[model samples]
Target: MLSFARAEGAMGAFSASGTLAVMLDRNAAVILVNEPAERLFGRDLWVTGRHLACADKNATDALRRAFHVLLRNPTPPAMLNPVPLPRLGGRPLLAYPTRLPRITTKAHPVR
Candidate 1:
């Protein structure tokens, strides 16, 4: 599992390398995104707090299913092929989901 710091480092490398990349938390929320990704998605604003499912309304169901499968499986899949990104007429992009180290807290009062 990738730690938060490691994930951030990875994102930096990816950004420097001009690779389109995004890091999502276990809950499938956008945690980090690179420049190429921003251009590809056509947005310059920070998307860290947004959920991936809501990022692309056209691919909501597909994104939800993909995230669900990744979350449920112990191992990451080779790739989530042909993920439709919210772009000009919805372009398909290959997606890879990496598991991040689960953050545990003591406050377990409510769900």
Candidate 2:
């Protein structure tokens, strides 16, 4: 499981790399997301009941496949290519799934 400390580290890596990050669970539900990622949601993309969603039908279909690959990949590479999130306007966002370390951190309970 990706601990909160690892999540923070992942977020830092994402920021340094100029990429927005979204972490999903095995069932494809949104576990957590960085601020930059939440801002990416507007017209083309948004969270539909804790899952990433797309306004465009084609993009939605594409995201479904990407999510499957992301969730079910058995090998270590996780994903060989970044999943392309198509937007109605502006450049498409490339999503890369990463595994965070297991180190834990104390924090307030989820309210």
Candidate 3:
């Protein structure tokens, strides 16, 4: 499995890979994108704050539903295959929704 010490590191790795990669937050908003992904999607604009569903209205409803399910139950990653990319000649693509590790906080008692 691919691992990154930080989100920036992950983005750097993704940018280096030839395959398209995208990282989304629990809210389904894009958090990271790579060069291949930008070329595949044919846009140079910033996508970090944009929701994936905004690209294709036909899949918006279903994508939102899947996002909700993933948020509710995030133990195992969710996969969405054959996703239609209307902007890319309606080409099908695969998407994975994985949960990011949470940071724990604990109060320490002073002696």
Candidate 4:
């Protein structure tokens, strides 16, 4: 899995193939490069801290709802159902959610 760490932001770990992945943080932002994903959806100009839905109203609303699902589940979700991007003047892409591992607060002992 792609292990990325941002001390003040979030962590998204995906496999080498990039098929199965997980995103954890207050922001539900991501970067994608599929032809359809790029053509239908907008790209993050800054390359960071930008979600595809920010510019698209429909994606924004759907993403908001997906966040709600995470909010309701304190234990974190086991899986994220796919969310289709708005197509009719909407973000033209499909987003699928995959559950991330539970974060544990264990400390490593120094020898």
Candidate 5:
């Protein structure tokens, strides 16, 4: 498993592997997003002012719930159950959230 000892390493690996990864803050605002994910913007997904969103109400609800799953659950979920991305054509991509370890930024240290 890739570690976020440094965000660069994990983000780089995800980019190299062609995996779409979005790092979200407690408020569901995006902190970072991979290249593959950028393609999703203005299509199925939207990142307005650092907050990720979708056009479909159901999809948006699912996405929000998925994020909360990570926040509320003591144990990490094996998967976010693969929520489907909206599509105009082709198979929809599945979106899932993975919790990062409580990484302490220089400004905030973990106890």
Candidate 6:
């Protein structure tokens, strides 16, 4: 049962081709990403070691707020507004962020 559960969980993460799972550090830096996430963020793999803030100020701000909220409750998925990614040839993407426990700060009540 455990083995089946583990496999199912792993498969779930890769179930969607264009979907992404982004891991952010405390300083708002990209820590880890799956292959699909790399394509989704587009060219961001080149800037992986840098702060997400350097990519796009507007997106950075939005990400910060969403990160904070996620750290607090770690529930209720947040939808990141669609934005034009110029580095990716001005392609539009809607990033839906889910707050995972390890990537978040201390847990708090959701308001």
- Model 1 scores worst on lDDT over the 10 consecutive residues at 40-49
Tens digits of per-residue lDDT for model 6, 2-98:
5435434543575465455655555556655566656654454245446443256676567567666655544645544443333445544555555
- Each prediction's Cα lDDT score? 0.63, 0.71, 0.57, 0.48, 0.75, 0.52
Best by TM-score: 5
Q: What is the lDDT of residue 35 in candidate 3?
A: 72
Better of 2 and 6 by TM-score: 2
Worst 10-residue lDDT window, candidate 2: 97-106
Candidates by lDDT, descending order? 5, 2, 1, 3, 6, 4
Candidate 4, residues 40-85: lDDT per residue as tens digits? Answer: 3334211235544544566667766886677456776765777765
lDDT of 2 at 58: 72
TM-score for candidate 6: 0.50
Candidate 4: the clashing residue pairs are none
RMSD to native, candidate 3: 5.3
RMSD to true structure for each model, in Å: 7.1, 6.0, 5.3, 6.2, 4.7, 7.9
Q: Estimate each model's TM-score.
A: 0.61, 0.69, 0.58, 0.50, 0.76, 0.50
Q: Is candidate 1 or candidate 2 better by TM-score?
A: 2
Q: Candidate 1: lDDT of 105? A: 31
**After aligning candidate 2 to the native by TM-score, how far in Å is the CA of 49 from where it should be?**
1.5
lDDT of 5 by residue, 1-111 (tens): 122446767777899999888877677778778888888787667887776777676877787888888877778675668777676665766787778766555555769
* Model 4 clashing-pair count: 0
**Candidate 3 C-alpha lDDT tens digits along 1-111:** 123346657667667776567676657777677777776554312343386643555655566676776676746454544344344455455554445554233557999
Q: Per-residue lDDT tens digits of candidate 2, residues 1-111?
A: 447567677777877787778877678888777887878888878888888887677766677677776557665453536667777787877666554433465677998
